[model samples]
Target: MNVCIEDCTPRSASVFSRSNLRLESTLQELSLYDFQVDLDQVGMVLAKMFETNPTIPGVILNHDSQFIGMISRRRFLEHLSRPYGRELFLPRSIRALYKLSQVELLILPGDTLIVDAARLAIMRSPEQIYEPIIVQISETDYRLLDTQQLLIFQSFIHQLATELLQEQTQSQLMQTEKLASLGQMVAGVAHEIRNPVGCIVGNTHCLTQYYEDIMQLINAYEQELITPRPSIEELKEDIDWEFLKNDGLQMLKSIQVSSEQLKHLVNSLRTFSHMENKQRRETDIHECLDSTLIILKNRLKVGIDVIKSYGNLPKFLGYSGLLSQVFMNLLANAIDALEETANHSHNTAKIWISTHVADSCPSQLRSLIIPPKNNPEYPQNTESSEDPLTPNSQYIVIRITDNGPGIPKEIQNRIFDNFFTTKSAEKGTGLGLAISHQIIYEKHGGCLHLLSTPGIGTEFEIVLPLI
Candidate 1:
C-alpha cells in the first residue's frame, strides 16, 4: 500500500508550523481517512474505491452499518495475489477475505498525543508495523491514521524540539553577555563614586578631631582666665558659641554615618554586579541575598516590608554572579508585585526572603515547573539528579515570597516560559524569570519552583545542591 506522502496535508498546511507544532497535538488533528465499507460488500467495490483513491491508507469496515474492523490496501493487495485469490474473494462477501486477512490492530483514542501514538505505533509487531492505526473518535465512529504519517509527525516534532532548544541556548548566551556588560558598567560607576565618598568620610573624621581640639582650647582659655573677660563673654553670648560647639560636632558625626552608609551601598552594588566572572567558587548565600536586597532597597522602600529568616547554610560552590542575578530577578519581581498591589488594597506590601538547609526535598518543593520536551506530563530537566533528596544529599533552599495579588493559576505554569510575563512593556522584558530558571536549572543543576495562590500571595523556591 503506497501511502502518498503528498496527501499528508497537515505539514504543508502549517499545522506543524514552528509556532504551532506542539507535542500535545493529537491524532485527530492530522489527516485521517474516513472512508468506510461494509464487511458484506463485494471485494470489487472496495477494490474500485482503493483504485480511485490511492491516498487513502485503508478503509474502516462495518457489519450491517456497525463498525467491525479495518483492512489496509497492502493487506488487501496481498490477499488478492494469492492463488485464485481474486476469483475466491472478489465473488464472495468481503467478510471471508477480512476474516482470513485479519492481523493485529492498533487502536488508539482520537485524543491520544501524537508522540504517544507514535510510541505505540512503533511498538507493534514487525509484521503489523506497517498497518494503519484504528483511531476511535467516538462510540461508533472510527478513522484510519497512516503509520507513515505518524512517523513523519514524530520526526518533525523531533526536529522542532532541537531547533527550540538551540534558540533557547542562543538567547541565554545573549542574555549572559548583556548581564556581563551591565555588570562592567555598574562596577565602573561604583568605583567612580567610592572615591568621593571615601574623601568625605576621611575629611569628616579629621574635622571631628579638629573640632574637639578647638573645644578643648576654649575650655582651657576659660580655666586660665584670671578675671571675668566681659568683652569675650559678650561676644560668646551674641554668637551663641555653646550651641555651635555642640551642634557642629553632632553634624560632623552625622556626615560620617551617612558617608559610611554610602560606602556600604557602593560595596553592595559592586558585589551584586560581579557578573563578569567565568568560574564558580564558594559563595556565601546570605551575602548574595543581602546584596540583592540592598540593590533593590530603593524600590522596596516605597511600601514593602521585608522579612528575613536565614538558617545555617554552608558555603556553596556555584556561580555567585549568576546566583545573584537570580536573586535580583526574584527580589525585584517580589517588589514589583507588592507595589502593583499596594494601591489596590490596604494590606502591608511585604516580601519575605528566607533560607535554610534541608537533608531532603521539601514536600512542597517535590514540585517541578520545567516545561516538557515531548511529553506534556513530565519535565526532562527536573530529573537532572536521580533522587533530588537521596539519603546523603543536602540542598540549600531559598524562598522569596510576596504578599500581593498573586499570579493567576492559569498563567502560573507558564511564568518561567521564555518571554512570558504579566508586566507592561516598560516594566518587563519577560526574560527575567526565564533567565533565572536557566541559571539555576542549567548552571547549578538546581530546581526552581513556583507556588502561588491567586489573590493571596506568591512564592518562588530555589533549591541548589549544597556541594
Candidate 2:
C-alpha cells in the first residue's frame, strides 16, 4: 500500500482514515495527535520499529491495543543492551518492560487548551520534556501530542499581540506631541496680546480724564450766561447734551471694567500653560491654588460653595506649575460631579480644600509609600521609602473634598489608567487624572490617592515629600 501525508484543505472530512492522510492547522486549532504513532506488537517488533526510526525521540507506546506508559529511546536502548537483556525481556511479555518507562505519561482531556497543556509540559524534567503528551479522547482511546509544537504556536500568538500594542502606543504618542505644540502656541499668543491690551487700558484712562475736564468747563460757561439765548437752547436740544454726557461716562466705565477682566483672563491663561522646566524650589502651594481658583472662578459662580481651611504651611521644594495643574483638574472634576448630582437631587453642592505641612506623612500617604500587597486597588511601589532607618522627611498634605455622587467601587481602581474617563468625549479627554497621577508620583516622587462613598462624597489626598 502507498501512503502520503500532506496539509488538509478546509473541505476535508477525514484526513487520517485514508492512506493518503493530510492535516491543516492554526495556533488555536492545533491537532492533538501531531506526534502520535501506533504499535501492533513488541520485543523484536518494537526493536525493528526503533531501528527504522532511530531519530524519532519517543512514542506513545500501546500493547495489544491498550494504552501504556511513555518510553524514552535512549533508556530503552540502554536497558536492552544490558547482559542477557534479549533473553530476559525480548519476546517475553512487554508488560515486564513497564519498569523501564522513564517518563510518567500525562493524560489530559482531548479538549484541554494548548496553553494549559504547555504549562504542564514545562513542569516535566528535561529528559521527559520531549516525550509525547497523551490526550485521552475516551476511557479506551488516547492520542499523543508534541509539547514543543504547542509552545511554538503560543510564541506566534504573542508576537501578533505585541505588534498590535506597538501600533496603539505610537498613535497616543502623536496625540501627545500635538497637544504640547498647541499649548506652546497658546502661551505665546497670550503673552504677546497682554502688551497691546495694557497700552489700550492706559490710553482709555487718559481719555476719561480729558472728557471730565471739558464737561466741567461747558457747565461753567452755561451757568455764566445770565441772558437766556434761543440759539444756546437750540444747540443743547440738538446735542441732547444731558443724555450724551451720562451715556458717555457709562461707556467709559464699561470699557475700564472689560479691559481689566480681559487682562485677568490673559494672566490666567499664561499661568495655566507655564511650560518652564520642572524646578524644585521653595514655593507656596496656597498661591498656586489661588491662581487655579481664579482660572475657574466663572465655573464656581454657579452655586458651588468653596471653603478653604488653610493651615500655616511652609514652602516646600517641588514643581509649582504641575501641582497647580493637579489642583485645577481635581477642582474642575469636583465641580462637574457636583453639578451632575445637583441636577438630579435638590442638595447643595459643596467643595472643601484643606492643606498643612507635617513632620510625618498621614496614614493614607504611608499606605502609598508601602502599599499593602493584598489590596489590588492600590498600586505597588517599585521601590519603598517608608524605612525607619532613612533620614526623617517632612511632608506637605493637601486634601480636596466634594459633596457629590461618589465614584463606584468596581472601577475606582481604573481612575489613574491612561485614556479612561466617565465624562463625554467633548467634556473630557480622559487624560486629566492620569496626567495628575504621573505628575505627583513619577515627576516629584509624591503620592496621590482618594476615598469615595457612594451618595455621600469623595476626597482626594496629595502628599509630597518636603526638603
Candidate 3:
C-alpha cells in the first residue's frame, strides 16, 4: 500500500534561538511535531504513516478536517502489542481503536510559557507523563510537542538565569573593590597635602609678625630723620618704600587666604576617603554630600549650579563611605548628562538636591519612602513591589534632580541593569547607576528610583531608613 505522511513539518525546521530565549520564552518558539492524520482512516493506514515517519512523537487526529484529538507513538505501539490486538484493530478504523482505549489529553495554547508548560506537563499521571502535548496554534491549527523537548528548553533557560546571576555578583564585587582602592588613594593624597598646607599656614603667621616689626623700624627711621639728608631722600624715593610697605601686607594676606582654602579642600577630601571603612558610623548626610560635591568641583562647570536645601537631620547610623560613593555616582551622572547637551541647553544646567525625613515630607512624596522592617538588620528589597520590606521606623529621603535632556522612556526601565549603557564603552562601563542602586538598595536596605520625562529632566530619589 502507498501512504504519505501529511503536514509533517518538523518544529526544528523553524528554529528557536538558544541565545535569544529567556525566562519568559513561550511554547511557540519550540519546534513542534505537526503530523496529522484522518481519524476515519483504518488503523493499518495510521500504522503505515507512523512507519513512514519513525521519528515523529505523535499524530494529531482530525475528523472531517476538524481537530478531534491525538495519539502518541508510545501509546499506539503499546495498544498494538496487546494479545491479538493487531488482528482485531489493524483492519478496523483508527477511530474504533481510539474510542476503545483513549487517555486524557493535555492541551495548551501556543502562547503558553515554556516553563509553565513543563510544570503542567509533569502534573499528569505517571502513565501519561511522557505523552505528547497538543498545542493549539490557532482556532484552525494545532500541533504536538514532545515532553522531553519542553523540559530541555526549560533547563536551558534555568542555566541562563544562573549565569546571569553570577555575572551580576562578580561585577558588584569588582565595583566595591574599585571604590575601596579609590578611597584609600584619596586619603593618602589628602594626608600628604595637609602637612604642606599646615607648614605654609604656620610660616605665613611668623612672616606676618616679622613684617610688622620691620615696618615699625622703618617708621622709626623716618620719624628720626633729624638730618633729612638729600642722599637719604633720594634713596627712599628710588626704593619706593611706601608702595613696597603696603604691597607686602597685601601679599601676606593673599597667601593666608589661599592656604585656608587649601585646608578646606583637604578636609573635604579626607571626609570622602571614608569609602574604605568597613564599619558603619554616625554619619552626617549633609557632610557626606558636601564632601562629594567638593571632590567633583572641577567637573561642576561655572554654569552648572548646585542648589541644596538640607533639612535638619540628626546623625544617621550607616556606612558613610559607601553612601558617599553612591552620592558621587548619582551627581557625576547628572553632570555628564548636563554636559552632553551643554550647547543646546545654553549653559543653563542646574542640579537641585534636597534631603528631608520621610515623615516630614509632603503627602505626595511621603508615600514613596518605605521604612525598613528591622532597625539594625534590614534585609534587601527585591524587584517585587508587592512585598516590600516596610517597617514603622523613620526614614530619610535624598533627591538629586537635574535639568537636562532626560532619558528616553523606552530604555529607562533597563537603566539599573548591570553593564547596560547607552554611552560608548570608553565613556561608561554601565555600572555607575547599577552599583549605586546596589549600594542604596542591597547594602543599606533602602530604595533607589529614577523619575524622568523626556526633554524635561531626570531625578534619582534615594530612600534610606534611619537604622
Candidate 4:
C-alpha cells in the first residue's frame, strides 16, 4: 500500500498533465455535497477520504467549489467530544463551520518559497489535519505537491514556528523590564508628593485653630456689649476696644503666615512636578548641586555638615529638574542614614558630595552604561559641539558619600530594584534608589551604583556624559 501510494504521488509530470489535472493541482478542491452533510455524514466522508488517501488530511467544503471553508479530519475527531463540539458540528454554513474549527488556511502559488509557505501554514495550523496542503492556483490551472515537496514544506513550517516562539519570548522579557522601570517611577512620584501634602494639611490646621480663637473672643465681646442689661458704663468697660484691635491685628498676622506657608507648599509641588522643562538646558553640574543644597538646607538635621569637593567640570546637556531629583534622593538618603546612625551615638553626621571630569570608559563605572538615546525621557543634542569633548565623550562623575551605617550586603544587590526597601513602609517607598537608577541609566545613558561597607557608610556614584 505504501509503495502504491508513493507511485501515485502528485509529481511535477502528473501535476502538469491533463487540463483537468492541472486545474486540480492549481486550485484548492472542494465538494458542495460534503459541506451540506450533517456532522455524522461529514465525519463518515472524512474517514472514508482519509482511508482511501491517507496523505490527504484536509478538504475544502464549499457550496459550489468556490472557497467557503476548510475541514480537517484530525481536528474534527480531536474536538468531537469537547464541550463546544456539538455546537461546532451543527454549524449552518461552511463559513460558520470554519469559524468554529479555529484553524487557519491559505492557498499558495506553485513557485512560493518553502520558508514563506511554511510560515503561512504554521500561522494557519492546517497541518494537524494531515500536514496542511497548499494548493497552487493559476488563471486556468491548479496543482498539489507530491510527497517530496510535502516533506520539505512540513520541515519549513516547524522551523518558522520555533523562530516565532523565540521572538515572542524575547519580546516579553523587554516588556517586563520596561514595566519594572515604570513601577519605580510611580513610587518615586508618590514619595515626592507626600511632603507638600503634609505641609498643606498642617498649615490649614493651624489656620483653623486661629480662626476658632478669634471667634471665641468676638462672642465674649458681643455678650458683654449686647446683653439684656442697662449698664452703659459697664458695657464700655467690658468692651476693651484697644485690646480687641491689637488682638484682631495679631490674628490677621497669624492668618497671613498660614496663608504664606500654604503658598510655599504649593510652589514646592509645582517646582518638583514641573522639573521636566527646567532641566532641558545645558546646565553646569556644579550649579545644579549647589541649588539642590540651598533648597534642602532647612531640611538638614542640626550638626549635619555638608562638604563639597567640586572639580573643574564642563557644562553638560541635561534636564535640571531630573538632575535635581537625583541630587535630592541621594542627599535625602544620606541624611536619613546619618540620622539613624546619630541616634545610636552623638557623632556629628557628614555628607560629602563631589563632581569631577572623567574619561569615557565603561571600566570606570561599575554599572552598565547606556549613552543617551533620542527619546521623551532624555533630550537629543541638536546644537553643534564646539567643546573639546566628543559627542559621546567627557562624563561628569558625581559621588555622594555619607558617614553612616552602610547598606546590608544581602539588600545591596536589590537596592535599585522597584519596591525593594529596608526601611519601614511609612519611612521609605523603596523607590528613591530605583528612580535615581532610571534617571541615570534610561534618561541620561549614565550609571548609578553603590559602594559601601556595613559598618562604615555607603556611597552612591553617578556618571553623566557631557557633549
Give one digit per residue, the lDDT tens place, for model 3 in 418-443.
77788887888888877777677667
lDDT tens digits, residue span 1-467, model 2: 01111221211223322222212222224554322233434456556555765544445566555666655556667678999887876676455665665556777877666567777888888877777677777776555555665666555455555675576467568767876776688689989999988987887888788888888998898789887599978888999978999999889878878888778777767766767574676667887887788889999999999999998988767777678789999999999999897778787789999998778754545554422233344456533453321236677789999999999988777787666789998888677887787778766767777888888998998877775
TM-score of each: 0.75, 0.65, 0.74, 0.40
How well does model 3 score by local distance difference test?
0.81
Clashes of 3: 2
Among residues 3 or more apart in sequence or in different chains, the pairs in candidate 4 whose N, CA or C atoms overlap within 3 Å are 25-142, 25-143, 26-136, 26-137, 26-142, 26-143, 27-142, 127-132, 279-319, 279-320
Give the lDDT of residue 427 in candidate 2.
88
Query: Which candidate number has the best TM-score?
Result: 1
Query: Residue-pair clashes per candidate, as listed?
Result: 0, 0, 2, 10
At residue 166, give the lDDT of candidate 1.
Answer: 89
Writing each residue's lDDT as its tens digit, candidate 4 over 1-467 gives 00112222243323532333221122232110121222323344544555665654455454433344456656656665688765655333334445567555555766555555555555543354244454545542323333245445345445555675577557546655664565456446646766766665676667666766877897697788765455755665689755765686576667667665545544443334334633456766776677667657676746789999989987777776677778888998888888887879666788999888877645435333322332244333322242122444777889999889998988776777555678897887666777777777666766676888998888988878765
The lDDT values for all models are 0.81, 0.70, 0.81, 0.59
Q: How many backbone clashes does candidate 2 have?
A: 0
Better of 1 and 3 by TM-score: 1
Assess the local accuracy of residue 247 in candidate 3 as a C-alpha lDDT between 0 and 100. Answer: 93
Model 1 lDDT per residue over 295-335, tens place: 78788779788999999989899877788889999888888
Q: Report how far off residue 238 is in candidate 3 (Å).
A: 9.0
Cα RMSD, model 1: 5.7
